[model samples]
Target: MKGRFSHGGGAGALARGRLARYGADMTQSLPAFAQNARFDVCALGNAIVDVLAPCEPAFLEAKGLVPGSMQLVDETQSATLYDAMAAGVEASGGSAGNTVAGVGSFGGRAAYIGKVAKDTLGEVFSHDIRAVGVHFDTPVLEDGAGNGFGTGRCLINVTPDGQRTMCTFLGAANQLTTADVDAGVIGDSAIVYLEGYLFDPAPARAAFEAAAAAAHAAGRKVAITLSDSFVVHRWRAELLAFIESSADIVLANEGELHALFETEDFDHAAAHLGRIVEVAAVTRGAAGSVLFRGGERVEVAAYPVEKVVDTTGAGDQYAAGVLLGLSRGLSLAQAGALGSLAASEVIAHWGPRPMVGLKSLAVQHGLSL
Candidate 1:
């Protein structure tokens, strides 16, 4: 997992100096957006509930599961896995859903758009998101009798090292369509964030394009996250096209970055990212993150946490902080620091959502909101 800059000597020194200069340019401003926008961030992705359980490494081996991969499964497969799992906890979660929830936890105005069925889990998803102070009013898909699918759910297995492996049943979550893209919501938000995990379905991909178009028409920015490395490998060409044509910001991890550029060389992938997108943020787990903007790169250190309970929503919460900070006019370095702080908090808990108020936590860490 080592990259060029991961080592010491001349190359590392050069990167550090560049990062210092980039950090000093905090006075620079981002592109202007409508000052009257209602929500700071509007996120679009699958609507799903998360079922998390702790297990031994042997459990994953026995199940023939990769320790840190996400796989799409059918309803029957999902049920069988659930039945075999140990006692677990259920919570409302999805890539974009968790990001918006993190935004709300930071006292930012946030909204969510995703498809859910008229079922029990759908009700739970709606209630949990609203309870966190995010606005979500997407029309629910009607559940037909004997359809065998009502709502989407992810079965997450967290090993002792905090790595999470997920098996997701998309179900009704894949039903999001262009018609579900509310132009008003797009226009009213400072930034519209799209989730890569939802790109598998044609309808959902269409919805992403529609939302991006609406945001641009109203002069707002659009951000996108490469939710998983597997997703990047699946749709690299399409994602590049979408980012070039529509996205103002791109968020990803080191693995996803590698997948996107089809390279093992981190420097090559990051350089390619800088040339294609206006702003890019790549998280490197414990090694921290790197931000690329206007040919400058800033490196932000990972915030300290005593223990890692689960790594489920680490990237999602990181997106939450960076997106919220950008919407509030924070510099890229400051935004990245906020992102690191938020990520640290989430990985210290069992679920993806924050256990404490992120705003308060940021203040305690000397990061002004």
Candidate 2:
């Protein structure tokens, strides 16, 4: 909420012009609930630990793995892949978890809700997220409980080109239920973010609904991210229905957006999205992103990156920036810029989380926190 920047031309002007063309009320701004909320953003997602290792394209081929796809595996399969992988780094990561952590890195009051097992990886996940300053107190699933599931973990194989292919075991993360949705946390946050990856489970889906209802009842906003193209493909109709009924904001990458609408045309998908959600932000990798609100359209360019070390968590970090910006009353164009800045920083590293202080990096990039 401090060091805000002035709106400039180009995308900003285009957005305004588009609003005028549609006769939409340009004076309507994002809700002011953030001003009084105890937390800026509370995110719900799969609680996962990521094991990242650099590999060659041949490694993926030998493993019968697609170069850049995420496939779900069982505990035995996950263990097999981990053993075959080279020395790797382990870190706490999940779509919404990374986003909330990024929010905290930008000096926002962030919180997270997810189910992890009472295991070593779960302990690591809890300690790491809290260490980053995000409020995360969701109870750990009791050992021997949760239908015999343990802590969830992801095995990520990053090729030389920085593309990441993942094998995930949901495990205890899939045990998240409506009981885990804290109405108090949902009501206290300015925005509640739900991760699409959690949509596959019945209980987690119910939890999402409960959280959305609590947020709306408390006059808070709800944001949902189409986590991946695979996720969109898996729950297209259900996701569309949820967005229409509960979400105020939608975030996605070009692939996910295209999959959601079953289209190859970006503009067509974006236009349809504008009509459904109050706000939409779609990322197009190095080409940057486009933001839509009502009938207005804003195209923000990608921030420059020196090198792309690993492409993991680019979209999650991008969500972190845009969500934080919106909570602080920034315009759509400004929010997109923050998203681009955060994304550029993450892709230049080896992990999903930012290696540098995002708040300081934002200031250096001329973006006021």
Candidate 3:
């Protein structure tokens, strides 16, 4: 805890000295290490390429996109909209992709499993994922583009308020079959993570089920995140079934958890969910996060951020921090605190990916990532 703030939440003079030594411009500028540190975790989710563009509210209405929500679009619709948009930043994306990426940022060893076409976007996705130090070994589709279906892409529109509206075109991501679930990958890692969004597609569902079975048989753990509210509304019964059957650790934000339990009150939904899953963590933005496990409860305060740019990958990165902490043998409360810390860093920026070096950033805060 050297050079960090005191127990009262105020930084000490030692912290100031360390901050000065690191660099006055930004503590995040510190480089990340621990690429082959032999992590205690790994994950599997949809591998997607993100196409982010600056957008006006009018553009959303003209394109019939619901502002502040994720809408699944068909290949034709995705192409039509994409063709009309301006240039964008193509980054590696997906629910679990963000989580695993955040894990890598914090110097945790992680791997990802998903599908993409053997095209430019796919190459970008693979490169970005690997550059972050997450092992990815899925086979890319070679014949997708000839049939008019391009690679899996997400059209992300960032508004003036820093809110993001997402439109997803599954494409090759939907083609993630059971064969893509490598038993060795499942066995080698300490945990396997799945995204609730992948449950909507039949092929992805089969792949997830196979992966879960492999992880369980190998004596590894299984984790799941309820990706969005609509996904829960559309597949509530199935998600409930998944909680009972496969999920060992479940992560959800306040809104998504309420919708999943069909309740209006957060306390009501959280109480109900706590009884069903082995471990449940619900994130309340600004209000912080809560954990329920073994009839015990823990509440972790939200780490303060100077600014909230884009709320795109806050929850995903939060899960990454929590999982990384757990892999490092930290207590649940410690894990949740790390999750809050990582999430605070992302909200201070514009992209889903973390711009800060999470490793030394944690060390500055007297934390070990």
RMSD of each: 6.4, 5.8, 7.4
Per-residue CA lDDT of model 1 for 1-369, tens digit only, reads: 100111112224323332112122432332367357889899999999999999999999999998899999999899999999989899999999999999999888999999888888999999999999999998988862148657899999999999999999988888889989989998999889999997898999999999998998888888999999999889999998898878888999999999999999998999889777777899999999998877678889998899999999999999999888777666577778879999999999999999999988876766655
> In candidate 2, which residue pairs clash?
none
- Put down candidate 2 lDDT per residue, 1-369, tens digits, no spaces: 112222223344334432111112422343466646788899999999999999999999999998888888998899899999999899999989999999999888899999999988889999999999999989899872346688899999999989999999999999999999989989999899999998888899999989998898888889999988898999999999999888889999999999999999999999999888888999999999999876679889998888899999999999999998778667787778878888999999899999999988877766765
Candidates' lDDT values, in order? 0.86, 0.86, 0.77
TM-score for all predictions?
0.91, 0.91, 0.87
Rank by TM-score, descending?
2, 1, 3
The residue-by-residue lDDT of candidate 3 on 1-369, one tens digit each, is 001101111123223422122223432322121112234466777778888787889999998888888889988888888888777677788879989899889877788898888888888889999999989989888887666546788888888777788999988888898999888877777667889889889989988888888877766667889998989999999988877887777899998998898888988889888887656789999999998766767788898977787778889999988776544444567677778888999888767889987877778786653
- Is 2 or 3 the stronger prediction by TM-score? 2
Comparison by lDDT, 1 against 3, better one: 1
Better of 1 and 3 by TM-score: 1
Give the total clashing residue pairs for model 1: 0
